[model samples]
Target: MNPKELALKAITDVFVRKDITAFDKYFSKDYKQHNPFIPNGTEALKQFLPTLPKNFKYEPGVITDHGNMVMIHGRYENWNGKNMIAVDIFKIEDGKLVEHWDVMQEEVLPSQSANGNAMFPII
Candidate 1:
């Protein structure tokens, strides 16, 4: 699969559809996560997903594909009200996601922005 397709499948299958087994199909065995709080392995994420609140949602907006890597901009709406705007980068090797990095900021409302525009263009 191409990098963008791999990224979409990884997030949509696992986080959106709640299909944990998709990790085995989309992620490499040596997958490395750069997010500090999460451990560095596919197995770690597999173990963590079920622990998330039922209301947690990942809504992807814009995607930038660059050959072997893809960057996704999205919203992570969790049950705790810590909605975040995030940029997730995935590196693909041989059709599998092998490395990941992410940066997130709390989503700002239109009222909070000087220009009154929401952080997510899709919303």
Candidate 2:
């Protein structure tokens, strides 16, 4: 699959579907994670997944690609009891996701925004 397709599928499988097999299927064995709260490597991610609240949900929005990197804008619900908007970046190598980074913020309601604009664009 292309980098964008692989990234979207990986994110959906791991975060949305909570499918543990996705770690093996889409992640490199030495996957490097830049999310400070999570340890480096796919194995660590596998161990971390189940600890999230059962109501956790991931909703993907816009996706962009450049060379081997893919960036996805999405929302996370019930993440530590707060909704979040995030831009997740993935580096793909050899058809597997080899690294990741993300910038995230607590989601604010549209009514709370001064400009009345959504953090995530309509997809």
**Could you say which candidate leads in TM-score?**
2
Clashing pairs in 1: none
Task: Give the alpha carbon lDDT tens digit for every residue of 1-123 in model 2.
Answer: 999999999999999999999999999989998999888887777888899898899999999999999999999999989999999999999999999999999988889998888887664
Clashes of each: 0, 0
Whole-model alpha-carbon lDDT for candidate 1: 0.87
The candidate scoring highest on lDDT is 2
- Residue-wise C-alpha lDDT for candidate 1, range 40-70, written one tens digit per residue: 7788788878887888998888999988989
Question: Per-model C-alpha lDDT, please?
Answer: 0.87, 0.93
